[model samples]
Target: MSVRTIAVKYGVHRGTIPTFVLRSGGKLRSTGLNNERRASAAILYRDGHTLQEVADRLGIDPKTVRNAVVAEGISPRPRGRRPMAI
Candidate 1:
C-alpha cells in the first residue's frame, strides 16, 4: 500500500508515516508505476504507442511511462511526428 493510503487508513499525516515506518524497521516501498504497470507500458510502447499516449491510457505521467519503457529494455521512438509515406 502507498504511504498516502496508509495515512488515510490510520488517520495519520502522510509525512509522518514514512518516519514511523522507518523507525519501526519497516522499509518504504518505491512510488509510481508497479511491475504490472511497467509491463503494460512496455507492451503499449512496443505496439507503437507514444509515451504520452501510454501515460494517458494508464493515468500516469509521460515521464513515468518513458522510464518504465526504458527499464523494460525497449528503445523508445524518437520524439515528434512520424514521417509520412508517399
Candidate 2:
C-alpha cells in the first residue's frame, strides 16, 4: 500500500512517522564502573551469559566485553572519552 493507506490504517500522520523512525542521535556513552564492570563481565562470561548479553548489561560493546574475556588479566574500562583539560 501507499503512504496514505499506511498512515490511515495505523492512525498516524505519515510525515510525522518518518521523522520518528529515522533520527540519528550521535554516539551513546555508557557510564559504569571499570573494575566492577570488567570483573562482572568476566564472571558473567564464566557463568554462561553470552558476550552480547554482558555487553548490554554493562553498557559496553560486545567486542569490548569479548576483549576483556580474551585478555584474561586485563579489564574493561568505562565507556567514555577522556576530557580535555584546556
RMSD of each: 5.5, 14.4
TM-score (all chains, Cα) for each model: 0.60, 0.43
lDDT of 1 at 57: 95
Model 1 lDDT at residue 13: 93
lDDT of 2 by residue, 1-86 (tens): 54567689899998855555456643333333476666787888766577777888888888888777766664444444222345
Best-matching candidate per lDDT: 1
Name the regions of candidate 2 deviating beyond 4 angstroms.
1-33, 73-86
Leading candidate by TM-score: 1
State the C-alpha lDDT per candidate: 0.87, 0.66
Residue pairs clashing in model 1 are none
Clashes of each: 0, 0
